[model samples]
Target: MTREAMAAFMFRMDGTSSYQAPKVSPFADVKPGDKFYREISWMHSQGLSTGTRQTSGKPLFQPKAALSREAMAAFMFRLEKPKAYQAPKVSVFSDMKPSDKFYREVSWMYASKLTTGYKAPNGSRSFGPKQSLTREAMAAFMYRLETTLRLK
Candidate 1:
């Protein structure tokens, strides 16, 4: 799903059925009256997102872009807000290095067993950070996250 759809889903899951759009949108692309505007705004207000980029001094949400696996990892990590959490010193996935953006979040997901990643032919695991997250993958991630939350 697109980032905006995910944000809207997350907003509803957080028990926010309604929200008022911010007077000045945090995202340059998400203006008032736009689809998913209130939900995206709520996501930003709740500190779940800060948008994808900045253009002309305004944050850009890239609402229509497909959500990537690494991006999902970041979102889930931010939503959980684990206190005093630290990323592993070494890389867990063959495709991702410790120096990569979102590496900490993806590593946290692996450490938490929220994801096992795909097993490559070489027997090493790959996180596929740039891959678009499939619906099934998204559901699995959310289910694991919810289950983890319940246990905690």
Candidate 2:
């Protein structure tokens, strides 16, 4: 199963835009009428894009792969907008070069205090937006969002 599919499943299950890490196997062979594919389609319908990280023109969800910061931030940004949530900080990463594609996303997550910065004693204060976002890190960020954004 792909990350997008799993995210879609979560979205459908809870009627919320957020995704929680699934505890069970989330993949199935690609085929028609499959629940997995249906969720992917559902996410697309909801405007959660399936990024162009595919092989042979097929989306590669790579369910086991860790979610990247870019991916997580993108998800949160799309999910948070309807709630009228404003990020707490403009940009949390001091080292994130302005030219990076995710500069704005990192800024939004930080401005809202919805993210964990990079390895810094001050609380991962310097987020490397390009770096991979880990499951643990994602959980922590969600916790922060629940508190700061008041969403759980």
List the candidates' TM-scores in order. Answer: 0.91, 0.60
**12-38 per-residue lDDT for model 2 (tens digits):** 543544543343322333344544555
Q: lDDT at 86 for candidate 2?
A: 44
The lDDT, on a scale of 0 to 1, for candidate 1 is: 0.85
Worst 10 residues of 1 by lDDT: 11-20
- Using TM-score as the measure, which candidate wins? 1
C-alpha local distance difference test of each model? 0.85, 0.57
**Residue-by-residue lDDT tens digits, candidate 1, 38-119:** 9888888888899857546778889999999999999888888878878888787999988999999999899888999999
What are the runs in model 1 whose C-alpha is more than 4 Å off? Answer: none
